[model samples]
Target: MISLGGKPLDIAAFEQIVLHQKDINISATAIKEVTRSYQFLQSFSKDKLIYGINTGFGPMAQYRIDDNDRKELQYNLIRSHSSGMGQLLSPLHTRALMLSRLNTMLLGYSGIHPETVQLITDLINNEAYPCVYAHGGVGASGDLVQLAHLALGLIGEGEFWFEGSIQKADKVFKKLKLKPLSIHIREGLAILNGTSAMNGIGGVNVIMAHRLVIWSTLLSLMINEMMEAYDDHFSVELNGVKRHNGQQQIASWMRAFGDKSKLLRKRHEYLYDKKVTEDVLVDKVQEYYSLRCVPQILGPIYDTVLNTEKVIIDEINSVNDNPIIDRKNKNIFHGGNFHGDYVALEMDKLKIAVTKLSMLADRQLNFILNPALNGKLPPFANAGRLGLNFGIQGMQYPATSTVAENQSLSTPMYIHSIPNNNDNQDIVSMGCNAAVMCSRVIDNAYEVLAVELIALVQAIDIRGISSKLSPATKWLYNGARSIFPYFKEDFAPSQKMREVKNWLTETDITGHFHKQL
Candidate 1:
């Protein structure tokens, strides 16, 4: 079990809990600190005017509330703001949001009761997800609408995704012997006012994007092997001249992956051995940019993914709510810690990087399908008679269109801020929107890579070079063939493409390569 509040959660621990469904435990010291903060807030706010404690929230903060209506005011805030509309986030993302929120609360700065953290922990361990919507968060004021739905479920009034179906939160709570969160002080504002929504989604996006970079690098090497391209492009001597760490690392991975391959050619052996005697050379001197610039193209993407991971982990561990309850200083400080500019900017950068990766995959797929380009395989890599059957020709259109869609979606959401909340949040950050769009781009990249993998396997078979592949590429070829065998005849590729996509997402083909980094 991963323990929270003792130390900040890193990407590895977050991945294990969110993706692998590992359980969590709260530290004893953290629980004591949380109780101390709660007690301090309760006593300190009896006479003073604290925001969200006696006064209203956001633009309505000027209106003072009565002592008797303070507890009911919290309930009203949660109920009124539960107006999110759109598709529900997948259970994976919902669990991530829950974990992110729980971690922040355990910092003992939210002034939330210890019972609130316990309920969230139980919900996460039980796999009972709150129904969080995709649309309603402008990412300003801490994803107000989206988190309101999370707060709604915590109060036993909204829906819970139980056993892959939507059920009443009260029903699930009763069935699992879990109690709903009670309104102790500002639990509504404490739950709703934070950056956890965007942070959680952006964290998952960063993880998937990291995996995409690894797969992209592997595929780039495999294609070079299939085409028998020159090895000088990714050589240590060539990339070591560049100052970028990402480029050097990618070059290293390429060298390691292609070390055992029999298909790669050395430049000195082919060209530098002797001078050319013919006017028209039989061998092409260099490959297309897509095949030649693997390090340069994917290096920035690698750096972007890693940088985004750091920013997201920092956000996850930060106390991102307003009115931070500092018991040590014996003061309650109100500020805009709830703003999401950091997450918004990082998500935007990540989507742009992932979109470019998809473009590279699409171009590589196009290169393999066009026989005129490589002068090796038949048109469209058709194994059957040219006129009688079309091989993988129909699959290229979706890949192209999908990459185009990703390109259009890569426009930055950070710059598209619109004033809302009566202009109180005039310069808001659309962080959640950026995270969601980045996720779509990552998903699209997977589809394109799946198509490219199938075509590469077919090209390998048509060239009759399957036996000469390196161990890493050969393992990929065999694994892909198990999901989709060598297809020469004209057949529908929709189902086969999906199977490969699922395998790519579910499988970890780059573990050994990842360790080298």
Candidate 2:
């Protein structure tokens, strides 16, 4: 179980709750703080005009609301904004959204009632996900529309995903023996006015992108082994001269991966130790840039992913709602804490980094498929009779096209803001769009990597070098072959490709090399 409120939540613990379905325990201190904040807000706002408690939201804040209709006002805010339209977020992402919102409230600055916290906790533990959408949030003023749908579900009015199907919120609540969240003061605005939606999606993207990098690294090493490429490029002596931490770390991993391999060659052992040879050497002196410059290429991607992780973790632990309710300081300050620029910028950088990784995988796939380039392996690595049968040729089309699509989608969403909400949200952040697009890019990269993996194993089998592979490469080869056995005849590869993709998504190959990032 993951513990909240006592210590700040990090990415690892967040992953445990979202990906592993671990239950969360709210701290006693956090519960007391939530109660204290609620009481303070109730007493302090009785005679004062607060942002959402008394006045209207956004441009309507100039209007005054009477005490009699204040509860209805919060309800109106939730009901009016429950206008999200598009595909429903998967249960995984919806659960992450709930967790992100919950963590922020647990900071005890949102002035939310203790019951709100308990209800959200129950929903998460019971795996009843709100039916949030993909297109409703512009991410300025914090995923307003998408989170309003979440708020709608909390009030037991909208649809929810339970037991692998959509059910009405009231029915799900009844079956779970739970009560809907009652609007005490500002639960509606509090739920809608935060960066949780984008933060949650971006958090999952970071986890998957980190895995994508490790998979690309392993695939790069395997390709080098297939070609018997020179080891000097990833050698410590060569990469240490570069002043990048990512470069050095990637080089270290490559060295470790090739430690016991019989296929990797030392340049000096063949060239320097030997006497004068033929004027025209048959071996190519250096490899293509994709094979030789892996450390340089993937180093920036590694650094970007790490930086993105830090920013996302920071956002999740923050109080992102407006009108900070500081019970300790006995004050309420209004501002734009709900803006999502931090998460937006990080998501843009992350998608670009992942897109580059996919480009590398595509290039390596091309190198192995063309005999003119690698000087080995038949066209498309076809193991059957030449020209009579095709091997993995059709898979390359989707891989290349998918990489092209990722390149197009990598256009930054950070600067694409359009003023809306009656210009009240001028200069807004399109953070949710960025997070969603980044998710698509990560998903596309996985497909591309899956195709590359299939090609790598096929090349290994064609070369008859299974015995010479490193232990790490052999593990991958064996695992992949088990999923997609050796094929020499022409057949449709769509299903086989998906099986490999699913395996890549579900398997945690990073742990075999080092601790997960």
Candidate 3:
């Protein structure tokens, strides 16, 4: 069970709740705070003008709303703002979105009723997920349309995905013996006005990106063994001189994973008095930059992923709603806490970093495929006749295409903010777009890694060097090879790639090597 109060939500705990169906409960203090905020807001009537409670939202804030229509106005706001397009978010993403929004409201700053909060908890705990769309959030105004769709489910109006089918939320709520949530004075606006959508999606992406880093490091180690790379590139003595944390950490990981490999050579052993004869052709003094600079290149990415996690977690824990209700101080502060630039910018950086990681994997895969460059491996590591079977040659096309797509998607979404909402929402932050794009890059990167794993294992098998691989590298190689065997013939790799990718995501290869990272 995860407690929602006072403390920030960690990604690990969030994963348990989202992926494992862990139960959730609001803290007693959070309950008390919510009640207090709601009571304070009740003191004001429609006659008394307040930002989200009485007046219209955005530029319409200048107009005063009357008494009877206030509740209807709240309801209408959700219906109007629930405009979303494109593909729907997965159930995992919807649950994460709900969890973030619910946590924000639990801070007791959104003036939400206890019933409203409970309803959100009910949906999450009971595995009733709202169908949140991928588009419709500008990232400023706190993913209005996306969260609005989420809020729509609470009112028993929108569709929900339950038990593997799309059903009416109203019918689902009834079957579950739950009542539709009644909107109160600031409830609808409070739900819609926050950065939870982008933060939630980006939060899960952060976890996935971190996993990708671990996978990249692990895969690079296997490639290192296959290419017989010099161990000096990952030496602690060399990295310590550089004084970069990520570089040093990566170097340490490489040592931990690659040190046991029989194929790796010490730099001094190969470099000292080496001659270039036909029998002793020293074609390379050191590995290429992709193999040699894994630490330097991926080290920064490691730091960036961790840093982005910090910002996203902080956003998840804090209240981002406008006109924050401070009942104790009897004050209301309307500010840009709802702005998603923090999440957007960090997500953009993560996308760029992860895409670069895919490029590294692609380059390394190229090295292992080329006979001239890959330590004299066969063209495509073909065990059979070369022309009859194109080994891993066709696989490179998708990896190259994905890297190109990642580069195109890496354009920063935050800088492309377009003005909307009658200029009231001018200078918006496209955080949701960044979050979506980041997820796409991460998904594509997974395929790239999966393909690279296939090629690397083929290289190991073709070279008949499985006996010489380090324990860790062999474990990963065998784990993958078990699911997808060596491609002696030019069979379609899509099925094999999918199985490998699925296994990688489900297993704890990254967690097992946590100490290294």
Winner on TM-score (2 vs 3): 2
lDDT of 1 by residue, 430-515 (tens): 99999999999999999999999999999999999999998878878888899888877777889989999998887755454565
How far out, in Å, is residue 405 in model 3?
A: 0.6
Order of quality (lDDT): 2, 1, 3
Clashing pairs in 3: 142-194
Error of 1 at 428 (Å): 0.5
Q: Candidate 3, residues 85-157: lDDT per residue as tens digits? A: 9999988889999999998898888888889988999889888988889999998888999999998999999
Assess every candidate by TM-score.
0.98, 0.98, 0.96
Query: Which stretch of 10 consecutive residues in model 2 shows the poorest summed lDDT?
Result: 508-517
Off by over 4 Å in 3: 44-47, 272-280
Angstrom error of the Cα, residue 243, model 2: value is: 1.2
Q: Give the winner by lDDT: 2 or 3.
A: 2
Model 3 scores what on Cα lDDT?
0.87
Cα lDDT for residue 243, candidate 1: 95
Q: Give the Å shift of residue 468 in candidate 1.
A: 1.5
